[model samples]
Target: MSEEDPDLASRRIAHESLTRDDPTGWFENLYSAAADGAAVVPWDRGTANPLLTEWFEASEPNGTSKTAVVIGAGTGWDAELVADRGYQTTAFDISPTAVETAQRNHPDSQAQYVVADLFNQPAEWQHAFDLVVEIYTVQALPIALQATAIQKVGELVAPGGTLVVIASARAEGQPDAEVEGPPWPLTKATIRSFASAPDLRLIELDESPSPSNPTATRWRAEFLRD
Candidate 1:
């Protein structure tokens, strides 16, 4: 028999979680396993996402005197980048191990790392951030949960705030049946749901070749709240 794929353990944990009808639970399982050296988090790149950096360069967002949050902050590279940009940043993950690791990864990090569920966030977080960065977190859940996830992410943006989403993109009409994933790709229509909130406007949505895979597409969308 061929050796198991390196990410098979993570996929198995995700599948079991999904089978239990717990879409977000696998995250803690995976992160805990990684912490114990029994498995690895496939998405932990150990550096700030380049797409986010590209956005920062292009938009020159002035985070000074602003507040930001990084959803599914993982090991905190993205949160650190946002903190470095001068925002009072709060980064959160559903997994406590992940949050602890992020805190450990950046000992002197300015960002507040917390264990927060995307589905049930704190009351204070409602429309409370000037910037919200959601990189691949929504896509990591089942496709059926996309709309609710998008709406919750949007609700975090304060008046005049901006929300940036980066994720793997699929063709608009692509069949969901064909996509088996712990990382289900998002389509154009699904992405538009980010602006479904009455107060949010989709300012930009770009579908381009993924930096990690030239043939695969990536979506970098930006939304602004009224």
Candidate 2:
């Protein structure tokens, strides 16, 4: 038999969480297990996501004196990069263990890492950031919760600020029932829906081959709030 998939533990936990109607409750369970060395965080790449890095290179955003927020910030890689660009960064994760791990992983990092649920975000965070970075966070949730999650993400962007979303792409025609996932990949239509809010406008949406899996596609979309 083939070796067991490394992410199976996370998937199993997610399944149980979803069955309980607590879609996001698996995050803390998985992160806590990973902290005890009983499981692994399959998505913790230890470096900034390549899609995010590509955006930085192509846009050359000057974040100096500006504010940025990383949604579902895992172990701090993306947050560190944002901070490196001179943005006053706040990176938050629903899992307290993940937040603590991020702090431990980057001891001298400048980003303010916190434990915050996207659905119950602090009032001060609404429309508070000059730049909002959401990488794979939406897709990680159950498909039914994606729309609300996307809205919360968009609400973080200040007027005139930008929101960048990087996610594994699913063809628009693909059936959701066929996709087995803790990550139900985002379809083109769902990606475009990020701009449905009155305050948000879709600026650009690019689909490219995933760096790690060339056969798979990834979507990098940017939105601006009016």
Candidate 3:
């Protein structure tokens, strides 16, 4: 498949997997096909997200020896950033292929890459990390599952720990039903929900146009567990 054009076959297979009531199966199939550059991963930015990096720099939390978890770790770029900052990072994906791909991509990485479902995580992982980074993962799921994903994301933050959420932004009255997506941009209200209905408070919430595409925007939010 050409990098310029995403392989529709892979996407179709993934969508069918979801249609079959297998949420994680689509990710597995997508990653398996993406191996060896055979298919394009639309969200694989190929580098640690700049928004996350900047947040780390601004906060300068003493991450030394602290634990961090990167949700939907994909190819591990975000996890690598956390590890490099001195945190004991666990980068997990529901897709075993994605975990394996990340390990292969960065043989020297200090981050521990694992295959695990976000909805059914390890017992010890609940409220286990000093930091939890959720970047574009929740929005990737079907709208029906976003609430569950949001709840799980909050569950990972330890007492007084931090949560960073970065995702595409959806306008207040955009009539989302008309849009087609595996990546449904998040609305401000939905983003705020992460700060509420849970024991967390919003620290900062910013929405701005993506530099790459001015017409498209993103929500960069940070929250603190109470």
lDDT of 2 at 52: 95
User: In candidate 1, what residue range of length 10 has the lowest lDDT sum?
Assistant: 1-10
RMSD of each: 2.0, 2.0, 1.8
* Per-residue lDDT of model 2, residues 1-226, tens digit only: 2233647988988888988988899999888878887778878888999999989999999999999999999899999999999999999999999999999999999999999999999999989999999999999988888999988998899999999999999989999898899789999999999999777999899999988889999999999999
lDDT of 3 by residue, 107-132 (tens): 99999999999999998998889899
Model 1: per-residue lDDT, tens digit, 135-164?
999999998898899889998999999999
Model 2: pairs clashing at backbone N, Cα or C within 3 Å: none
Q: What is candidate 1's CA lDDT for residue 54?
A: 91
CA deviation > 4 Å runs, candidate 2: 1-4
Candidate 3 accuracy as TM-score: 0.93
lDDT top scorer: 2
- How far off is residue 118 in model 2, in Å? 0.2
